[model samples]
Target: MAPSSNTRPILLIVDGDPEVLRALAFMAETRGYGVIGCATAAGALADLDGSVSCLVLDQNLPDVPGVRLLKQIRDAGIRTPALLMATSPSAALQIQAAAAAAPIVEKPLLDESLFQQIENLLAGA
Candidate 1:
């Protein structure tokens, strides 16, 4: 689907590391998705709404674990699709994210697949 009003679908990217957040924001924006970078889980959660089409979250945040945040997102009745970024996902982490209806994105996040995954999550293709 094409963006409406020249406004792309919003991607809320949360990561504790400044560099990673900036890089992801740049990439998303370049790909034509509206981007919002959050350094803390609280900030991301605070910004959640129907406008946020997808969430790309780091496994460990300064304030809350990504899985916990994902769970909170689901519990709050926010149906936005979320992708959990983990360096090396364990079975438990995978299970946890799945329980919250989020899929895991293995980290060192350098791949075209990430964008495709986001598109798939948003069903924008």
Candidate 2:
């Protein structure tokens, strides 16, 4: 669907790493998405609402794990698409996230792959 002022795709990025957050923000904005960057899970949770179309969450955050946060959001009935970014999550953690239906994205992130995932998610939405 064509992005309009009232329907622009909103991507919420929850990561504590400054460089990664900046890169993700630049990539999303360049692709015509409205990017919202938060350094903590608390911040992202606070901002979660209908406006956000997707979430790019870091696996390890100062306050909470990404999988836990995803569960919280799901329990709250917010079914926005989610991508979990991690350097290397445990096998059990990965399984849990998968069961929750959130996709995983590896860290040291590749721009092309990341963009492709974002595009696919947005398009599917």
TM-score of each prediction: 0.91, 0.89
Against the true structure, candidate 2 has what lDDT?
0.84
Best by lDDT: 1
lDDT of all the models against the reference? 0.86, 0.84
Give the clashing pairs for model 1.
none
lDDT of 1 by residue, 52-110 (tens): 88999898899989998888888888878888999999999999988877778788877
Residues 27-85, model 2: lDDT tens digits: 77877889899989899999988889889999888899998999999999888888898
Return the TM-score for candidate 1, rounded to 2 decimals.
0.91
Estimate the Cα RMSD of every predicted model relative to the unseen true structure: 2.1, 2.1
